[model samples]
Target: MEKKFNKVVLAYSGGLDTSIIIAWLKETYGCEVIAVSANVGQADELEGLEAKALATGASKYIELDLRKEFVEDFIFPAIKANAKYEGKYLLGTSLARPIIGKKLVEVAKAEGADAICHGCTGKGNDQVRFELAIKAFAPDMPIIAPWRVWDIKSRDDEIDYAEARKIPLKINRETNYSKDKNLWHLSHEGLDLENPANEPKYDEILELGVSPEKAPDTPTYVTITFEKGIPVALDGEKMDGVTLIEKLNKIGGANGIGIIDMVENRLVGMKSRGVYETPGGTILYQAHQDLEEITVDKYTAHFKQKVSLELADILYNGYWYSPLTEAINAFVDKTQENVNGDVKLKLYKGNIIEAGMTSPTSLYSEQTASFGEDDDYNQADSAGFINLYGLPIKMIAKAKEGSL
Candidate 1:
């Protein structure tokens, strides 16, 4: 007798692993499988996913549009904090999984699934990301991961199994590198990138960003408007979150703005090299940081940038479900209370330069700031203020003199 599962919901992407797991789950557990995919700006990657899931023996398939929520809820919050991992990475893939996982639980409950299955390999950060979300929402639900439980050890083995079973392989077998793409960014990993000596092939590795050499000669002047820390307009045109990103992407891509290549440490304990294209995200991040510089106070602004690094680590390491992340987000929200303004940026080739910023809450007064013509500052007032501020230095000097 087969160990029974009445129904299972899988976070299906219609990728190699997910495609294979759909058939395996039916064979192993003898259960009805429901495939659910979250559309977090994956573009055409999601095309034919529903038909493919049904072809692989799924009882039903559900695809929900989450691009707006992904931007407003997850991406905007991170942008408000200016979260970037390792001072270079933008955490594009990091913050996307939680939204995907949260959707999995909701679908599973509606479908009456006895368990939730995921296509994530045991060694990667996604397995932890997916499972933690399942645990948080449905603690008692049985979790199944095929890579951990099954005997398949390599991609070749998986392909062999797929071929014999007649499941059409979507990815070309000869293409060694794996790529993940979405509206926010696209990432390339494995194969030639695994070697540090090899420079990435420009022709095969890009989608959004243009080659620097191919970029137009003129610098692009762009303006972004934000309200209460969320981006609302691009280049003076008031647009929704989705439309705004798409427009900026066109401009940034033409100018080669957001292209990143680096070797980063994976949460699973390995050094991996990857190339990323974040055209729209790069522009938005630059605009957000520029706004913060003018709107936020000195102490809060500096400290929030520091907090951003920690936030990047958590999001990248799949710790989005922890208490620390909640606390950090609360702190970030408080800091963003004044992060509302318009930022003018000069975009040239691959650079994002801050031109100027104007905010109603700006502490910058021309009379106080300008040395050429400033009536607000009394020159005599500085003498007493400096003396009071330097008192500790004087005390330390006196103490040293007495000891000597």
Candidate 2:
């Protein structure tokens, strides 16, 4: 006999998996299923989700618009840290998971639900991300992952089950490709992406931007202004975080600025090939780094690179709420205190070229770095500096030759 739940709150996306899981939860647990959908800027995907959830037998459906909060809180912090998974991905989907998980736990508590349900599959990293956040917030709440416990094997089986129950679904076997979308990015996995050697059908898969080869021949110039490491203005107009990103997405997408295809290591101990489109996010990341080049010192910048790698790993593994991630973020925030400036970039065919950068606190000195002589510097000082720097190497060489 299956364990019974009085009421279970489910993370619903109105997608193939979650749409079917809502009915399955009600049938298996004999409980009231309350569906919650978090809109983190998945533009068209959120349409009619409430009606669909209710039609599929959910007791209630809740939609939370988290676009502003997602950008200001999650995306900005990751940008400040320069968090990139495996040096390519902008931590788009990885970052969105924790926020969704946290929100789901909040809803579960407010509704006084006995358990929480999710549709993450057994092999994916999302299962870990969702469960870890849930554990962090509500340690004792009963967690139900239907994909792991369900008897359904594949997409075909799921479709058949949904068809037998007459559940309304937009996805079919031929048109089905696993996708996740948020303001920061749109990620595509499974289907033809399962085979590493297969080239992605860009026409069918791309939703945010065009292919690099099809981009316009003429380059576009964009100016972005940052105040203390946070983007404040685009092309002289000040805007809020969400609006700014939206505008940039249009601009960057047209120039083919951010499209990535890679085979990444999942936290669940497997490799998955995914195609990601992150137009605005890629432009912002590059602009931020360009501004930092002038404001941040060499040693701090080098150390932050290591910190960024660690932060990326932390986010990828779903440790967003851990104390270590907090400490690292604090460090990242401190470094950004002086990262204020304007960065002008040229975008063309998926390339981000830094045209110029300026900051009031820049360490660069034109006079000191010039080839001509200056009163502040002496050419004779370098001989002593080189000897001191190479002392260990010279001593080792002398000892080997018995000249010590």
Question: Judged by lDDT, which candidate is best?
Answer: 2
By summed lDDT, the worst window of 10 consecutive residues in model 1 runs over 172-181
What lDDT does candidate 1 reach at residue 97?
84
Cα lDDT listed for each candidate: 0.85, 0.92
Candidate 2: global Cα-lDDT?
0.92
TM-score against truth, every candidate: 0.93, 0.98
Off by over 4 Å in 1: 1-3, 391-404
Clashes of each: 0, 0
Residue lDDT tens for model 1, 1-404: 64689999998887778878889999999889999988888878789999889998998999999999888888888888899988888887887888888888888888788889888887777888877877878888888999998989977778888887888777766774567666688888777888989998866677876877778999999999988788998777889887888788889988988999998888889888889888889999988888887788899988987899999998887778889999999999998777777899988888888888888777677778777757778888999999999999999998989952
Q: Could you report the Cα RMSD, in angstroms, for every candidate shown?
A: 2.1, 1.1
lDDT of 2 by residue, 1-404 (tens): 99999999999999999989988998898999999999999989999899999999999999988888899889999988889999998988888888899999999999999999999999999999999999999999999998899999998889998999998888889988899999999999988999999999987888888888888999999999998889989988999999999999988988887999999999988899999999999999999998898899999999999999999999999999999998998999999999998899999999999899888878877789999977688989999999999999999999999999
Largest TM-score belongs to which candidate? 2
